[model samples]
Target: MHLKLIYSKKELYFLKSVFLSKVEHGGASQLCYAKHCKDVLDFSASLNPYPPDISWIPDMKLLLEYPDDSYYNLKKAIANTFGCPPEAVCVGNGSIEVIRTYFYATIEKNDFVRIDPHTFGEYSLSVQLAGGRCTVLDDVDSRVRIICNPNNPTGSILSSSELIEIARSLEESGKLLFIDEAFIDLADERQSMINKGISNVFVSRSLTKSFAVPGLRIGFGVGNPELIEKMEVIRPPWSVNAFAEDFAIKALENLDLLEKSCELIKKEKIWLYEQFERIGINYVPSAANYILLNIGADASLFSKKMLDKNIFVRDCTSFGLPRSIRVAVRTREENLILVEALEKCFQ
Candidate 1:
């Protein structure tokens, strides 16, 4: 005989509804294309088309051994890069893991988490998963505020002074602020709040986009030592794998390669913008590696048309921008192919 298990109504609802909801994201080439489509070019995800040279492989001995539970070496490397104390760094599997950790560390049940409407979806999803409420930035009563610098999809950015003032205001009001600077390396690093030593603010940085190592999944958070310590408590041990830790350490030592990649991205961004102008495609000016195009109707059909040619772009309907599509700056050759494909779609 089978024994019946029991769950509370609230628990059952969460399991059936919240947990079952599908999560959408960009850079899903495997999902968007067939297994054998080796020629598929992805412009949906924002990543440095030219990644830093990581030719050397990790030591075989390290692969056999478990990663450091505290991720001490990785944190030290990130601290040095950002010019902050190691105590102020908290490494994670990715920026998304750090984001969820922040929510778990700070939010109590039913607490309010404020975010800009068009920012990353993870901010809202994380808050909801933690049993917290999500509010818009215009709302005055949130317990926490989260912003994505050089925001996703739109690629809009807030100035350093503007971010500082927002942090100060939130601090004065006894609220927490989280600034996601995942794309800041591709933008202006000088405008980053990572080295600001702001007590009430936490800056989340990703190695995935800028380093072009999304598969390795490395990210970190910088904040006051006390807050970092609190996040560390809730973060799982060995959350960052051995390979990722080694990769990040090596990547940090070679800053020149990252700089070169960003330079290429900036140049290609200009070319892409000019192509959009020539094609009479409406787009938002971007500070990061991606631009948002206003396609004048649902972007699904346009995206499908491009995908048919082995080119993929992000459909921004889920971001509440129904008529917009966000495309990342690719290599000159690749961008030209996309332009020609888009011309056909437009015609």
Candidate 2:
């Protein structure tokens, strides 16, 4: 028997539009690539290719017990790592979840949320889904502003003092400033606003990229105690699993490895840029671990061609860049493979 669902015109239109909307993201879509290619190299996702040595095995006791709903231990670890008071720390399943929860806690219906073009797409989607309107940075009427430091796709970054100035202005006007520092660790930690004691500014940090545990999905936010509490109220209990918290706690213990990885990425990034120069491809200078290359062709087609060579790179069309693609800093051997594959695309 077929059951027909009846809905008003407005409701039906909303449902249809939401269903039809495309969600674009970059990463090793292993299942999608496995069907068409063999021995695929993933340069699409910007993660620490040389991650700290950590065992995947989970403790049996933690596995059996339900995660702490408050995320007390995880929050403490993040606070200590960033030198912030534990009261100001909020842990989540990932930085994206933390961003969404912030919106849920702070954004009112019909409020104006400001975002920069070429930033992460999820910010706009989150605002629209919460019945808030999105505007660009130039819009002075926005009640909230979200900036991705070392922004995705472009890899441009703003200094800590510059961010503080923006935050101060917004605070004076009774507005909120949210900084997405997902890639900041790959750059400079000194530029982070996490432990700055800024009242109106909220900083979201991702453990997935720096810690190389995207599958585990751990992230955290630092802000005013009151704001952190508000987000916690709306966040689902035990959203961060037991294994993820324990894993993150362990990762934090090894700061030396994280530092070593950052130094290596810096060195490799310079080398990658030099390669791009020698190849005569236009590329954006980046402080983060990724670079954007203007391939002077259809980016989607170029990505597919590279995939045919068992190499994967991010198509920048989703970030409103149709002629460019983004690639991550990897080991020298892996990067040589990418360079060879990229050169073929020009042929």
Candidate 3:
């Protein structure tokens, strides 16, 4: 009788089935595992809708050859933009590459802390690959959290005061804090931690997002010079291509372009938010370019339904939120298409 008093096992089987079925197609170019899909009003990626100023492309062609050791000129341009020394900036193919380097450099086996239910699946994969124990900070211990200013998937933004408090706790605890601000460019730069010179905080940035240059694959991580130096030691020789470095140097020169683009996006983001509010869909307020909405209990089904009509969106089921969907704002027309598609789905 005592042995037969346990709970039923059907729930265990269902959990196991869901876990086993979670597989991602990493190498595919298209969104949400779909190929050759048309009528794409993709709100999956947070990249800028506008292209970069290309007035200097012809002159930049000279840099199509090999790169120098220092990445001096490129570094100088970035330094000027961030108001840091050239050495403080460690560039990479993408900030993701820099993230891998940091995990290997700063963390050892049995030493990693993560804030639960966040983006960057690769971070967990990298941490495990490096033989580190991944511990998550739950709601109970909100002090030492590694927040994503405007968090991905859910798209909720923490206030600057909240972030500062967490940073202070991590500093007191002597733990590392990695803040991925890849989508922050879509918001007010004044609200960013980088602008505040927050210590003990390593901020990873991706030009691929706000510049619409995912093809170029350029990004950087800013932190203390000592940590950045260690990361640079682990970085492969010539990790960034000549073309990417060249393009980034020139892109930095035209800072006005990025500024103007962000303004345009801010306007579009407000309009898109209004539409979402009007539709009565539940969405977290975002300071980033994307919005995450709870599209009822059948989000995966709704996402597939939208894909059939050729509009791609990020289904957050993989991120442990089955009813949530994350969508990036593009042009006014593109956002309208998504609104129409979602209206049809709900109807």
Candidate 4:
């Protein structure tokens, strides 16, 4: 040895893997480059095109004071929204935060988790950071399983019955289940497993996508009271900001409004699919607001060209599909703009 090492080999390897993992997300970063381009359309982030009317102004006077750490009202609102008890709820800055907090609260050294291969990257990173090993391949022996319903970059959804069966099996084995339903509201609320009376399952959901306000960043998790309490302990005090909390609480009060938002997105998705077919583009059948397209070209280059034309789309390389892109279903006019841009790019 030339010299004594300052770090262990295992630590160095783990850090290297973390450094190389893809952490890129859509929507926000692309806005910076689009400032110079007019009429830029960001189709990268999946959000409802017809969010319910929200007209609440934050109390600026309350900015001087800290929010109630207990978040009693917010929890109650979430419980009512999801048909769960308040004691079963845990709130976080966002669904991603709730997910990470759940992993940290439950995972231990040498614990292994299984995750869906074509889903969110945060699940794997969060598991690793929590000192748990994770694998994408199906392993009956894996102690925990994580999945994203209406999965990202693919938009495929499993029915509630399918998920219930899986949860039952996991429970039989004394294993854990974590489900991410961030896109469930935008897809089919009937497919939700939120109130399924399952003890071993924890479900995390977000209002960011459904409310079309990712900037607000409010999300929650529901589980058995014991597990939810554990997550609450790990959740930072006042993780949800005062403004977001207020918006979430009020939004939950009018959950029925999401039905219209869902119906509109479903219709828009069909129209977009027809346009894709007309252009000879291959697309995945999606139940959510976003659809995955097989462009038969380099995803990075295609995404860059689309952005150059004031249209931004999510390149699926981060989701491990290098030749595909994910485009969010927006309003009719906006979707028509996207179709025009697609025709131009392909031709």
Winner by lDDT: 4
User: Model 1: runs farther than 4 Å from truth?
Assistant: 1-20, 32-36
Give the Cα lDDT of each candidate.
Answer: 0.86, 0.86, 0.72, 0.87
Per-residue lDDT of 286-328 in model 4, one digit per residue for the tens? Answer: 9889999999999999988887788989999988899999999
Q: Listing every candidate in turn, what is its Cα RMSD in Å to the true structure after a full C-alpha superposition? A: 1.9, 2.5, 8.4, 2.9
**Per-residue C-alpha lDDT of model 1 across residues 198-242, encoded as one tens digit per residue:** 788999998888878789889899988888899999899899988
Give me the runs in candidate 3 sitting further than 4 Å from their true place: 1-28, 31-38, 51-64, 138-145, 195-199
Q: Model 2, 1-347: lDDT tens per residue?
A: 99998998656645754653445777776537375545789888899877878665788788788888988888888888878888998988898889889988888777899998987888887776666788885755887999999899888999999999999999999999999999987888778888776689999988899877788889889999999999999888999999899888888877557778888998898898888888888999998889999999999999999988888899999888999999999999999999999888867
lDDT, candidate 3, 64-117, per-residue tens: 666775677887788899888777778888977887787777766555557567
How does residue 129 of candidate 2 score in lDDT? Answer: 60
Given candidate 1, what's the lDDT at residue 133?
Answer: 85
When 2 and 3 are scored with lDDT, the better candidate is 2
User: Please, what's the RMSD in Å of model 4?
Assistant: 2.9
lDDT of model 2 at position 105: 89
How badly does each model clash, as a count of residue pairs? 0, 0, 1, 0
